[model samples]
Target: MDELVLDGNAAAGALAEIYGDDMTTVLAECASCGRVDPIGGLVAFVHAPGIVLRCTACATVMIRIVQTPSRTRIDVRAKRIPPPPETAR
Candidate 1:
């Protein structure tokens, strides 16, 4: 999965919207009631409350936003890492 550059505010929605990809699929969960929710990005989502960011698959609750005003600064880019493969194996 390729890391994407997203605006801090839209990071959750961006991930939830593109759930089909391998990278973002890491954000989903199933409830006892058999309902789906996307549970992801709890820490960063606090910039704004009432915003829903869930897992990409089971739709589990991940982020609980509380307080945030306009002009809040957040770094929303995923760090790039090289995977160890062929040679390492």
Candidate 2:
């Protein structure tokens, strides 16, 4: 089967739905390559199993989200999850 792909920005809505807030603006560092970038800048792929967000710099898997009938699992261990961006007053 063909693989589908897009930048991480496209997953904003889905991530927000799961986290109850906007997450696209958050920065994350690739654990493997140590290249930091916004979560919105990573590469993303959506498939039958779930969503996969990868580091654009090194192509390392940064985040994987799987949603089942009863629960959602997000694996960010391979990523350095950043705090939410500062709000503008």
Best by TM-score, which number? 2
User: Could you give candidate 1's per-residue lDDT for residues 1-89 as a string of tens digits?
Assistant: 12331222454443333332232324223332233332232223333444444334343443332223432222221222122123221
TM-scores for all candidates: the values are 0.25, 0.78
lDDT of 1 at 70: 39
User: Per-prediction RMSD in angstroms?
Assistant: 13.0, 6.1
**Model 1 segments beyond 4 Å from truth?**
1-49, 68-89
- Taking the candidates one at a time, how many backbone clashes does each contain? 18, 0
In candidate 2 the C-alpha lDDT for residue 28 amounts to 87
lDDT over C-alpha atoms for residue 30 of model 2: 86
Q: Give the TM-score of candidate 1.
A: 0.25
**In model 2, which regions exceed 4 Å deviation?**
1-3, 82-89
lDDT of each: 0.31, 0.74
For candidate 1, the clash count comes to 18
